[model samples]
Target: MLYGNRSTMSALSRMTEGNRLAQCFLFYGDKGLGKKTLAKWFAQRLLCSGTGEKPCGVCKNCRTVQKNVHPDVIWVPHSGKLQGFSVETVRDICSQAIVAPNSGDKKLYIFADCDRMDTRAQNILLKIIEEPPAFTYFIFTAGSRQTLLPTVISRLVPFAVSACTEDETLTALRELGWPDADAQEAVAAFHGNIGCCISFLEDDNVKLLVSLTKEVVRCIIDKREYDLLKVFFSVSNDRNSALWLLHDLEMVFRDAVTFRLGQDIPSISCDPVGAGMLAGKLSTAKGQYFHKCIGKAHDAIAANVNLQLVMSALCAELMSGK
Candidate 1:
């Protein structure tokens, strides 16, 4: 019972009625908006010998297709680090599309991350896409259709997968065993990307944040010196998203500090342990001091200050015996 976009499901249902289940479709959307999920589901439907709309999810062909072992269904990832389909890959795909299906009515090829494709590879794709085999279905996914060539664009039916509404996103999270408060925070933190929310939930860094934030707050309350540079360097993964992770960490810490000092903790961190740990370390003056340092640290980090220096200053400011 995987979730699906309601709008997309309706449009697809209409397409099934219109008999425009063309040989090719271009699915466009932001990352983690379930383009690949829907593509795979559609592939299963096409491969199924079932009587109705959905693949029976029980037939031999459907099971194999769901497990990604179907001979007639090919899933191609962007070949390069920057995320684009390769010319060689496109040629390979075309070669496969022409072959008859081993056990189904159609041979389905899904190209993920088509936005990374260069002009040459796209041109290669455009040729076969212009006159695809009657039994072949080519589904390409891109971040946006603007990245695709007009020639390629005109050959396929475009399917736009939009981000789910906040309520829909929250409901999905709640179904994943998250409490209402935690689900709300995860929705905001991941901007409604279920995969990213799951990533955050499973992150080792979050586990560390639970303990480390408590220890840092204890130091602040008891007036002991702590080193920020070591913590900062340990947390940042040498990527652009590192900053985002840091911001999220700081929010959790602030919530914990408030909870520790008998203040209402903002229900913004998904980790319950983190909230409880901070709650155990309450002191009025200490909480205020720590909150001020958090603001300063965020400002320094945002200004692109040297990471080590920012960490050092932040640690010194928050630690009591410094």
Candidate 2:
């Protein structure tokens, strides 16, 4: 069910076939790019007891791993309260890693969202990863390996999972029973991040955010700065929601730029009329300027700037560009 990353998958498939699979691998890239999925697939293949090309998909070991009941497979859980893997949890994993597998010859340990792990936790895990038992296999998934210690990164092979192509994303969405129009919209909004696309499709708040973004755009075009400020204030109390709205607004501007270019690209907004109106209002230069302002707002939010002040300034700047 994994889409894209053909070359990386091919290389991994070859490694497994040749029995040259490394003891540890670091899968890093954009979120929802299927790094964790690929790690699990590789682990299933490694543990499959079938005689044919590994996994076979029907073997008992593969089935158990698929159902997440495999005794030999260890999935390191993240602590939501800490927002990362705690040092205590990493220590427990190290203790578990030293033990022999219960059912298979090799034990596969998968750590997801590893970029959230602090240095202390990573260092503790690094010691085991450095001199892991012959029966142990480790896979770590992260948005970027740069967050990890250089010493830890040097001990493992790295695989970069890129986002899927537009066609691939559309196909996957359709396969999941999404309507053609809805799938196309999600693809445009998420830019082929399947995880984000799925989240957007399932969340009603995302629909509201898109609507709010369209309203903000309309306000900007009509020179309704006060109305725009009102809308911005409505979401100011919820930083996460406000940030998401800003992100959607950024995408709307991007779509306007695409529209001005006369390209037949998919649009983030479902309303063709509004898209046309916004596109007609923005010249290439203005579109670029607005996009830059939106990017600045995102940076300011990440820096923990005051929400009201940031939103007020952003609305003022956006209106000035009009």
Candidate 3:
């Protein structure tokens, strides 16, 4: 059961109830936004056999789907160093789509994290996606709809998933048996990103990133160029960690810009005091310039640029202030 984004859930229910659900569906959102979970729930609703609710959870079909043992439901996982599906994998899925359903009335293929899918792979899926068989359905979850090509986007129904309110997130975490202090700490660090909040509590890597993000923000605020570079160097070998750190730092810069404008913004900054200090130290233009540099660094990282070099250059860019 999802706690937030009732609008998207309602839209899914309407599509299912109205018998207007499209052959291809896209659920797009940032990491930890539960696109894949929503995809699973939608799958349950579509394949449920019980008499009451669409996904009468007690039914054998619903139970099998919940346990991921449903014969007619296929979960496509990524398979590469970059965690992307290859052209061959896409072709295999296309071939499998022509087969008859194994058990249920419909055959559903779910592709999670479609953001990492290469364009060639997406092209391979075009034919099946545009005109799938009567008994076939395709579902994809991505960090952003822009990750897919326009042709692919044109053939699919897209749903944008969003995080819950902070209050709601806090409540949900507590209901998960987290203590009040733990819940409040997670909420402060990650706001409504329930997955990330859970990660923050359980994953030491996440805790390190949070600390590093705060450290990076403080270094920027104090104009400590070398220290900034040094902090980034610690996580230089881990690409995902680097990206996560950059995103959190970007959030801090965003809050700083918001603070400069005298606007009250709900911030997910790990270092709110540093954000306020940055708001005083840098002009809006300068703040924005750093923010854009972060974007450049993000792209560089995504393109597989040398992480240490990228960090060094980003440190220089942030300190240059021109």
Top candidate by TM-score: 3
Model 2: residue 317 alpha-carbon error in angstroms? 7.9
1-322: candidate 1 lDDT, tens digit per residue: 3465767766665554445456788899755678888887777777777776566888777888888999888888666545567788878887877888887667888887776578898887877888888788888888689878998899989988866666777888888788888776667655556755655566756445544554544454455564444555665544334344445556566666667655763345444455466556645455556666776676466445676676666666666422
Give lDDT tens digits, candidate 2, residues 218-250. 898899999999989988887777878887777
Among the numbered candidates, top lDDT falls to: 3
Off by over 4 Å in 1: 1-4, 16-21, 204-322
Local accuracy by lDDT, each model:
0.67, 0.82, 0.86
Model 3, span 1-322: residue lDDT tens: 5678888887788777656567789999878878877888888888898898687888888888888989888898688767889888889999999999988768899999887788899998999988899889889998889888999999999999998999999998998899999989988888888888888888889888989988888788788988988898998999999998988888788889999998977776666777889999999999999989997897688667899999989989888888
Q: What's the TM-score of every candidate structure?
A: 0.63, 0.75, 0.95
lDDT of 3 at 139: 93
Candidates ranked by TM-score: 3, 2, 1
lDDT of 3 at 55: 77
